[model samples]
Target: MEKVLSKKRLQIPQVVAALKHRNFRLFWGGQCISLIGTWMQNVAQSWLVLELTRSAFWLGVVSTFQFLPMTLFSLYAGTLIDRFPKKKMLIFTQAGLMTLAFILAVDTWMHTVKLWHVLILAVLLGVMNTFDMPARQAFMIELVGEADLMNAIVLNSSIFNAARVVGPSVSGLVIAKLGIALCFLINAVSFLPVITGIWLIRLPKPVQPASRRCQEGIWQGIKAGLDFVRKTPGIFVPLALLAVINVFAFNFNVLVPLYAKNVFHAGAKTYGFLMGANGFGAIIGSVILAIRSAHGPKMRSLFIAAAGVSIFELLLVPAKSYTLAYLLLGITGLWVITFTTNCNSLLQVQSPPNMRGRVMSIYTLVFGGLVPLGSFLSGSMAHAWGAPAALGLGALISLAFTVALVIWRPSLLKQEISFKWQD
Candidate 1:
């Protein structure tokens, strides 16, 4: 028994081996602090929008304004990341986001914040995110190297989920006591640590372009990335499924708040608790993936996780009791981490180093870009039919996708296709 216990203890470090690297440790530590504040703002913003507009339709509108830029310019942003120094680009984006948060804080403090002010700020942040998401996602492998990419990605999810748990819980207290403006102010200040960490870190020399052909121009770069995804089944299939899921299943930002306010007749505290519950489940899922990094190809894991998410979401629609609702949300969170983390890590592994930025940009475009549409649908559905129905609609769409994938899984998994492209 003592030997078995010792063996278990020995395995713990292997699970977090990515943290042994200096650059990644620094980056992860900074992001852990930053993401907590980001989640806080997410909750506070949703509540604030509800407070300001008193309409779920406007909630969707706000979300659409925030994410619209990703749909418009993420491909160009991806090309920019591929050309520029990623860390520096991240600094600029983070700074821009910080400035927006501060503007929100001041506007709220002065009691001058209106629906237009909020929408404009959301649009600005969305613009920053178009550049930020792809750069950050692609930067992770560079920090820890490809050998530990799975562990690093899992750890990253764990931190984000940990923040998800902590942030809303804290925001609930802050909103209840200090008021909502403080949440935005706190989030703005939180960017400092990450900015400082990025500035201090040293990266290895970048690989020179092996062929001038790939670097011909911005349009060529965009076309190259698109063509790669178009032809690569391993990458394209998962992305297609992810995009479908994004459009219907991943409208939590809209659904959760509506359910708290309209369905449950709860306050900000209850909403925060619900979001925290989801985060708690997500952390559990991330831990499982961290421990077993070699869980086979990502597509298989993604499909399984998607099914779990859909089932839990459907269960959530009928959950009348607060406890039962929390339980269902938590279960959905667990599968959310598993599905997204697998999709991200798998896509990273499948792409060449040169194309990683563009591929992830496409990913950001599909995922972030579609949220506006989903949010609009979710908000509109909630306004018309109530929150439960909106939630059910998303759950049903997710389940339909899962059913379709299961039907096609055998042939999809067996087919071996080359990614080579000829123009």
Candidate 2:
């Protein structure tokens, strides 16, 4: 009995090996709390927009403004991330985000919230995220190093999805009972823990950029990052696949709300429940990745996950019942996280230390930066043909793109390179 107990204790760390590191544990815990608030705000904000405009196109517009900064300035942000301390950059960005949430909360509470107000706040939030996303991604290496990097990334996804599950469900309850303003207020308060966590984190001094690299202009630094990506096929292919998937298929912020409200004649509670179902499946996928972290990423896994996302999305097109739609979305959520986590791990592993920030910035650019375009496309389509048709069309484009990508680069599916990190 004692031996079995000891064995179980020993096995526990392997499941969450990244938590053994002090810095990552601190940041992860804080983020775990904070992201739930972020998700709450996401659900509330979408429902709020739908309420104000009664138009899906406006919802897309809000999403477009929110991510446009990433599209416009992510390359510059990447160069800045490489040049400066990511931790400090993150602190500033998080503070900015908290402030925006507060402002929105106040406006909503006062009953003066306008569509223009939401749009403006969203653009400011996007500006903060432009810096935050890449810096945060690149910072993971410093937290746990390459030995546990995959675990750290997967664990991060796990918390994010976990928050997705909790936040939206709670937001529905909060929005129904208290008000939408309270969701934004809670999100504003949630940033405190993460900011404190960042402040407390200690790290070995990061390698400063070379004098020559630092001396170069921002545009030159951006050009160099682009050139590196262009030369590296391993980094390039996953990003290309991500771009297609993100642009066509990642319009859930627009599609899900419209589907819940317009198609089902439902309310905030229904929207939250659907989003929560998706988040639940994503958590399951994250657990799978966490268990397989020791093996690192596989190209085959990446491609298969991408196909699964499109296939599940295609299934969603035919889902006429809420239960059917919910089930399909849950499966879609699983594939979405798996595909993205693999792409992220693959990119980080393939990038050199000096170029890591720039590489991940490009990753952020494709994964998130292009979402504005996708939002607009999906929103416009949803407005015209309905949410199901918009979703089906995007899935079809993504599926076709995935197929062509494989045919053009057969080596990608066959290749599964492994790496040993040298401190």
Identify the leading candidate in terms of lDDT: 2
Pairing residues by index, what is the TM-score of model 1? 0.95
lDDT by residue (11-129, candidate 2, tens digit) is 66777999999999889999999999999999999989988989999999999999999999999999988888888999999999999999999999999999999999999999999
Clashing pairs in 2: none
* Model 1 lDDT, residue 343, Cα: 84
Question: For model 1, how does the per-residue alpha-carbon lDDT over 1-423 read when each residue is reduced to its tens digit?
Answer: 999999889778868989999999888988999999999999999999999989999999999999999999999999888887888999999999889999998999889899999999999999999999999999988898867777888998999999999999999889988999999999999999999888887997767643543456989889999999999778888888888788888888888888888778989998999999999999999889898874434566788888888888888888888899988888899999999997887688788877888999999999898888888988899899988898888888988987897797766645433322211
User: Which is the leading candidate under TM-score?
Assistant: 2
What are the models' TM-scores?
Answer: 0.95, 0.96
Cα displacement (angstroms), candidate 1, residue 240, comes to: 1.1
For candidate 2, the lDDT comes to 0.91
Q: In candidate 2, what residue range of length 10 has the lowest lDDT sum?
A: 205-214
